[model samples]
Target: MQSTSNYLWLLKDILGQGATASVYKARRKQTGDHNAVKVFNHVSYLRPYEVQMREFDMLRKLNHKNIVKLLAVEEVGSTKQKVLVMEYCAGGSLLNVLEESENAFGLSESEFLIVLQSVVGGMNQLRENGVVHRDIKPGNIMRVVGEDGQSVYKLTDFGAARELEDDEQFMSLYGTEEYLHPDMYERAVLRKPQNKKYGVTVDLWSIGVTFYQTATGSLPFIPYGGPRKNKEMMHKITTEKPEGTIAGVQHRDCGPVEWSKELPITCRLSEGLKFLLVPILANILEADQAKCWGFDQFFAETNDILHRSVIHIFSLQQATVHKVYVHSYNTINVLMDAIFRQTGVPAVEQEFMYEGYYLELDLAQQVHLVPKTTEERPIILVSKEQKAPIGITYKEPDVPTFPPMFDLISDANLAKIVTCAVHQLLRITKSIMKCQDFILRGVYWMLAILKEECRKTLQRAATLNLKLDFCKSTMMRIQKIYGPHSRMNQSDGGDVHMKLQLTVHFLATISQNVQNSQKQLDQIAAQWSNTNDIHHKDSTIGKVEVLLEKVSAIHQQLKKDRMRMKLQYNDEQIHKFEKLNMGIHAKKVLALVREDCEQKYKKLLTCVKDWMRIACDIRKQLRSFGEQCESLHCDLENCEAYLNNMFHQIPLKLEGDQSTTKSTASTVYPDQKCMEMAIRMKQLKQEMEHVTKELQQNNMIIQSLSDGQKPQGV
Candidate 1:
């Protein structure tokens, strides 16, 4: 045990030990506050005096939340050697966290994000101060619990850190072997003769290795034994770019890289996050420094990710998982609002639970906590209205049943059963074809009717528009002759002019609707035609039938031969013939035929089911189209009625001098035409809304069917 003037350190309370110094947990005498004290051995002082003070100076110069803070410089009472006291991180080192059983595959995504933000912040600060941390690894990063009960990682152990500009070069190698740059590794680990100089980008390589390990719990590049035991192979794996190699990971010496462009299966990060993270790792871990990303670009991308919304999985009481995008600083209420927008559920009636504990709105203000969950352990959302035990349930889609396999009792019986199945399938296929033909003819007939209706409606709308235009011209002439004060202009002419404008607008809308409906009908017809032609040929069933016929003929011949042999030989001779394995050979042939027939039957059944589904879908679409046609027909009738009323409301004769000026509007436009057009427009809108709702429902049905086709595990 050792004691200082203001602090006491016990030998057994050591926090960490390195080659030059041993860090021990210390307590301040006055306040009893715990702090970490770094006591250096005599050998550490033997280095250049400038080297001895580098870490202290660097720590003092840098001031950032992610960088550990230096409290005070102290001296050991017994040794009289210099020591440094810093803030104590209760959560210990990141290496310790990685060693835990849960993180054996790697840190969870939430934990990894904390590490990413912390390390990036610390490195950005270092860059601002023109400092490069050559040793950036898990062991040198410490985890501290913040005031909000969240993990905050901080950079520690600045022994290998130094002030170096981006363009400047450093020859002295400093880093862990696995994380060292290839150029530095050659000189440091391999002890090879080289005069290569490294720049600030060397730190990027270390950061890459550190991050790769943190995300996947393993290094990117490795050898047959290890990076240390097989130094030559590790250097080759890191430097050489063979045709099949990826990120310098090979299955064996001189072998191709084992990984594709994806992360290892052991990685715990989601596929979406992995997509964003892999490029960063690839650029930083480049053996050729020229290709590596600059610090500015690196920081920009990482910060962009940090600031963007994070996706989290949430389940509604053990139902399917829903992905919710929320920012890390967003509160639980914000998450609930997002859920409500996606699921149409009120936030107030929902409760969230995480890891078997109720996640309160006040405590879980940061959405970053939600990323720790997964599909299996998603944030369970309980509805206050439903009172049921929480449990996950999966419903598998119903698979179609096929004809059962025939028992191979005798060659004749097996052949007979296969032939029967083939005949049955052929009949079913023929019936399906007949149904398809009937439906196709019906669709074509309906299409012809709709096309004629659409053309007639368009022509009627055009005729009405022309009459409305002539009425407008007449109204203008009336106004010009009446000096804007005549009773015709004030009372009847003004109303007639307004009605003409409304009628024109409605005519244009009706034309547009007809055109749109025509286009939709064409598309539906094309889709149905394509689906109907999908299984136009029954070639698969025909093949099965042909094969069964051959097997049946062979069985008949074999039966004849057996009868002939029985007639030619005695009972004792027949027994000897049975012992010759001829019966076994015939049975084998029947078994083979049975297997082939079963497979063909299954395939045929699947095809039939698919065709039936397509037919049903076509029927539904046709039904919807028919309803739309009826709506259009009603719209046309209303327009005709509105035009007739308009014609009656206006008078054709002008009893004054205006009779001399040929009136264009005449009695074709009426005073009630505007109100009638408005009513018609409102009705058309309601009908369109109904059609849209029906389409939406159909789309939902299609989506459900598609989901049912996917594997249950998915």
Candidate 2:
């Protein structure tokens, strides 16, 4: 071949030949590397231009090791021949591999699986790109000798490939007659347009036939005829069962026999291996296209066969492996089935124990949890009544309930709320841990008591706090609690009472959730504080503030875009105006489309802005809440110190003064320094009460903001 652009080629002998193209081994003069060049005969093809274009389009988009790589596409000037330079496979085709290995032991199970996986991988890539590989067979599959001296199979021949369109039909009768699916074979015989219709399933049928050939070292269906015997081959493919023989040193069908027994390869395999492979192979050979296995199912079943893991079953009394080397894919239910076989235990009566915890029977099918690696924990089994070796209890969290307004808010807002809650909990726990246990408990109890009082205060304040600035007409009309009727009557009844009850109910639930959160935080803080391992303090509040700023900026831009794209007229107005147009229907369709686009655009923008606003408000409230916690921490430390000093000042009980202790207690009760400390503690408690009120006010504000209320001066 002559040089084209930068590439110069020295063509060797022909590698393979097809109806439209011929593959030849070529050496690049520039790189001194060998590659395969598929030169197409433009004049010979029925639609040569179309064939060249589709191949180029599909090849350019694909990049995978298993799929043949298209190095370059060049045109031979003067002559209308176009060549596609691809990665050369010195190992030749799989057909040659099977022929070479026929006398020397046929392909091993592992080798067969490797080739199948590579083919499946390449086919999946084509499927993802919306291109169907219409032809899949042994001759089309080429093998490259890798650096590791092992053969790597690649899929070639894109001339028959076609892009899938919506609800499209395959009308062309393409590919080899022997490997063609029965449906396609029938279509080819009839040569009728209506009879030709298929999907990607035809390729799978070809793979099934290819697998039988590669596995048994011979084609499943054979035709006995002279040259030009495609009709005979098609007849065998359409009528005969896809059968293979595995007699020693002989790779052809000996007689009519079951595939499992007749195939000598399966005779050497274990019962379990035969059991799995039989069903998979059967599904692949299904005559009904709808019933045939797709890529996902095939890959999954094949994966199970390739990647095997062992599980060890034992009793609770001792570490003795009863059943070893069980399949990892075998579910707990399967283990129960095994129990019936080994020990006559019913599946319902059987319960599995792993790592001192009883596994939920509902999650029995998830056998992948069993350790596959050497470093992973071993699988343990025990009876339902059996106790753990050591005393261990699992602490599962209670199922959470969403706030009433949860459904009304966007997911982004919900996320921000949870994030803020976590930050506040962390802040409080870290600060409180620095003080005495009594001080921490005292602070906790103080908050608990204050929360109850705050609820009452909020209920009273709800009636007077009717400063509605955000959507007043909508809120007043829907709720009607803070309307003129209630204000004039001075009676909290009907909707007013119901709304107040809901507010208090929500407040109480919030208080309980807060307490539960604080308890969890306390446990975590205590565990880490005892070990002195909490070196890094979280700056969550700072991070959230920065995030809020970025969100707000993005929200503003989306809002502007939404406003600009808004439709100029309403649907009714547009419909009326279109009556004057020459093509009224066309104009009406355009207007309707425009209206739909505008509505969607506005909704998307509104959603974004609402989330940003929620995030900003939550971050701001959490910051203030953190600062209050820090202040409370300081007051707690001071109060604890003062109380400690007061106790220290009191006289210690003497061993010899049991009778005199009563006298000392009475006399030292009103000591001047102790009185001063008591007065200071009283003042600190009063400060705590003020802090409580401020925190409650903040909570109310957060609730109002979440309810779409505008901020105002308290």
Candidate 3:
């Protein structure tokens, strides 16, 4: 891994044409050992010589077992092409390996590790030098056959590697067909080809593609196909996930060839390998570069893996060290643009005003969206999944008086906002009702996630026959605090509503796993549940038994209230309220909004609208109440009659008691405390006055009858 001459020349005799460059089998000539010489074409795009020179400079500096050594760069007068000497691989590229796997690679964990470790490790070395490999894939990664017939992998072809000395978000298009990052695709579409510029982290994406094909023997994304055709395949890699692994098992056709069959999966690799590879590959292939791991992060992860300190991500995060949760959150709305069906924004004839953010729509756009009545439009949530940690916003090269455009959010940072907001709302509210409701939604969603996901996660804490309370008295606090008040325990509406949303989110996520586990169980439920039906000869049944054991352990964990206090703090609902300042106006409208200033009043409304846009819920009773009010306004007599019937048959439920509802439906913050209660009390008094008139009529009839009936009785 020492620096070589500025340029290199390969012997012309060994040169052979390749998809990219002229490749040849050569040697250092000094040592006369076999080495590969790669020469680039420089005329059309980059001076081919410059690209080779860049790679030479990088490879010569990069030193790692997982990476091939760049022994020397051949320099000759008036070079026809650039030649770089590298360790020649006798085993050849992984592409050769895949083409040879007619049935499947049938690779074991040890074998797959030989590839992944080499790929990740080599990339790690490049990153250590601030060099970001812009392309990582099967064609670029070659495997060398060792003396004992073992394959040692080597990463080559750094034509697109970028040296990032400072933090820079990738903003251009670069890489092979299926290996480009999401940002690259978007930028390519958005800008002119000449204008589009990309960054070095694109290498991570290519690496992800390579890993996918290396691990699964199929690209997570389809290669050589355009974006549309490969979307489904790409979508799965970016969003949908399977068991965080694949090994040992053979697959059979379930439905069709296009629809992959139930392939045999091997649970062979140390679970650590899957944990490290799956998430990283997923992020690397993220539909949005901003949402995926950048080179810096990729380097850190590979370094960690090289050291063999990879713990299950789920468990490791649970440890109290509390490193910021930096998972990618993409803008799903952007990816689903093809299907979300564009609703054209209408032009405002008159410039309209909003509290926080203003609107800018056109007449044509409005007409386009008009067919879809605004009343029943499908709500869109700002996907938390489609975004990456903003970290701290990059300080501008030059300071200006203009305001900043982005607000960064992380768990540590969010904790400050949440804790402060909770304390403020708690102090401001007369009855902790509003504050409790706010707190409930956040906690509920967290618990819901726990129920849905945490429960379903396959990670476990067990060893030495130690029954460490995976979840202690702390997680069970919900039952303790509101256990008696839970709906199952005759809980009130407030708790029930929050719990439902929280539970729904978790349940929805968990349901997928439930379906998966159930399907797996159902597939083998016949065999395992009944020993008589068990067949030792059937490997599928045996595999199912092993799956059942793992699933059962997971099921037990899911059933347990095992998620940490985070189930209370870190959920979408809570995040919406505290960090985003959601429903603060509901919790205390009077305090948050100013009645006198219409501008300030409108601002509160805008905030609420934004929150609702995220698809939060409101109480049903509130909806019915509005409908009843409208009916009364339409026909007083009919309304009064109906109310009388309702009064006799069913008492109106308390709004606060009926559900844990955020006032998402309302944008304008109603006056709170004295003003809001005073208005409501006034309306009730007027209703009482009207009822008194009806009672008076009845009073008169009874009195008159009593007077006349008294004489008749005598």
Clash totals, every prediction: 2, 1, 38
Model 2: lDDT equals 0.51
Model 1 stretches with alpha carbons more than 4 Å out: 242-246, 250-256, 311-714
Output the number of the lDDT-best candidate.
1
- Which ranges of candidate 3 are over 4 A from the true structure? 1-20, 27-32, 42-52, 75-80, 102-106, 147-149, 169-173, 186-200, 222-276, 294-714
Clashes of 1: 2
Across 401-488, the per-residue lDDT of candidate 1 in tens digits comes to: 2224312234334433433333334333333343333334434444554566677666555444444444454455445534588776
Candidate 3 lDDT over residue span 392-472, tens digit each: 111111111211222223333333333333332222221122222222232223223323332223221011001111111
State the TM-score for model 2: 0.42
- Candidate 3 residue 325 C-alpha distance from true site, Å: 22
- As a whole number from 0 to 100, the lDDT of residue 116 in candidate 1 is 95
Q: Model 1: what TM-score?
A: 0.51
Worst 10 residues of 3 by lDDT: 314-323
Each model's Cα RMSD: 23.2, 31.5, 31.4
Q: What is the lDDT of residue 406 in candidate 3?
A: 21
Q: What shift in Å separates residue 683 of candidate 3 from its native position after superposition? A: 99
Local accuracy of candidate 2 as per-residue lDDT tens digits, 1-714:
565553445456788988888888877767778888887765545685676688888888989989999999886666656778888999899877865512122355557767877887888788778887888988899998789877789999888898974245576778887678778877675453455478777887788778766765655555444112546443443344443221112123343323332444322222334445566666776666777777678878877765754344443212222333246667766756654454344565455444444456553674566544221233334333322221111121111223333121232233333333332222323222322222222223323433443343344234223322111222233233223654312542343334444544544454454455445435534543532322223333344344334433433333343445443456323322322221232223233323442233233334323322332233243344445434533443443344334323222322234335445665776465456555655764565465446545654774675465755675
- State in Å the error of residue 31, model 1: 1.5
- How does residue 506 of candidate 3 score in lDDT? 41
